[model samples]
Target: MTEDFQEIVETFEFLDDWEDRYRHVIDMGKTMPPLDETLRVPATKVDGCASQVWIVPHIEGNGPEAVFTFQGESDAMIVRGLIAILSALFNNVTVQQVVDTDAAAAFAQLGLDQHLSAQRSNGLRAMIVRIQSLAQNKLASDS
Candidate 1:
């Protein structure tokens, strides 16, 4: 649903080495504006991650047609970069589209699933689940 996500895929394709891709992910995270400390509440806190992570959803408009966007942060640099990647994955899309997206496939395309630690992969799945849950909730309210 976002061109930025496609751009990420293309960028990943351009980077041949894992180390360069890793740095690129970290650099992507560095570019993200920090999430507000006050917003890092228990409600936003993501479990199942070794690193502390928070995601706050911001939905605009009503129902399935609503836009889905979120602000996320993580204590770990790599996790923060993953959050940036997720932002590119889900931001500014319709709630319905968010619910329908194949996030695992997208990440697999980026070859992230093969490279990430098991814990990090689980954490990434957790983040995607959280985002999808938010979108589902939006759709439910619309119905």
Candidate 2:
């Protein structure tokens, strides 16, 4: 796991209850800067989510070795927090690392895997897919 995400895990361990964890997640979202409105176009928009969602990829250097990150947003506060969590999981990693990470297992460590509603879970999976697809595309292009 990325150090950023490990911090979240450690925080979750400190929190006493699910409510507190949820609050922490929401708080994380609250701090995320809103994505620029102009970038919320169709191309960046993620489908299959019940709430509106967008992720704009930011890559540094070039090719498969590039460091990958993104700025993301969602209409729902909880979803936005989820995006922040994903950022912790993915940000600053190589495009190859982003593609290789087991996001499901990482989220499982947070205990969100069991707590999220089916719809939210689906939405999360959709977001992961979008992220992985972007990394895969980058890798392919570089090759």
Candidate 3:
């Protein structure tokens, strides 16, 4: 659904090593528009991130079929890039899609699992958990 996501996959597939991939990710983060200051709040802050990360969900449509989008930011460049990847995958999609997505598998298919440090891996997993939780919460509220 995201053009950049496809581009990213293609680009990563082209790159031979993790070095270039890391740079691409950092570059993606550098280009990401800054998050609104007001959106960063205690309630929105994701726990277990190595950096200060905030995620907010926006929804459209109605009832159980409503679609959701996420906006997020992080103090760390790597973390921000991680957020971008998640956004690319989950943004502007149905809550059920978010719940069904195999985020870890997607990352692994990109060879990110082997490249990520323990802290980064944990942070990434936390982000996925948070996103899924948001979807689940919306489903509950919409019921």
lDDT of 1 by residue, 9-111 (tens): 9999999999999999999999999999999999999988999999999999998889999999999999999999999999999999999999999999899
Q: List per-prediction Cα lDDT, in the order shown.
A: 0.95, 0.95, 0.87
Candidate 2 lDDT tens digits, 1-143:
78999999999989979999999999999999999999999999999999999999998877878999999999999999999999999999999999999999999989999989999999999999999999999999888
- Candidate 2 residue pairs in backbone clash: none
Per-residue lDDT for 111 in model 1? 96
**What are the per-model numbers of colliding residue pairs?**
0, 0, 0
- Quote each prediction's TM-score: 0.98, 0.98, 0.94
Candidate 3 CA-lDDT value? 0.87
Q: Residue 126 of candidate 1: its Cα lDDT?
A: 96
Assess candidate 2 and give its lDDT.
Answer: 0.95
Off by over 4 Å in 3: 1-4
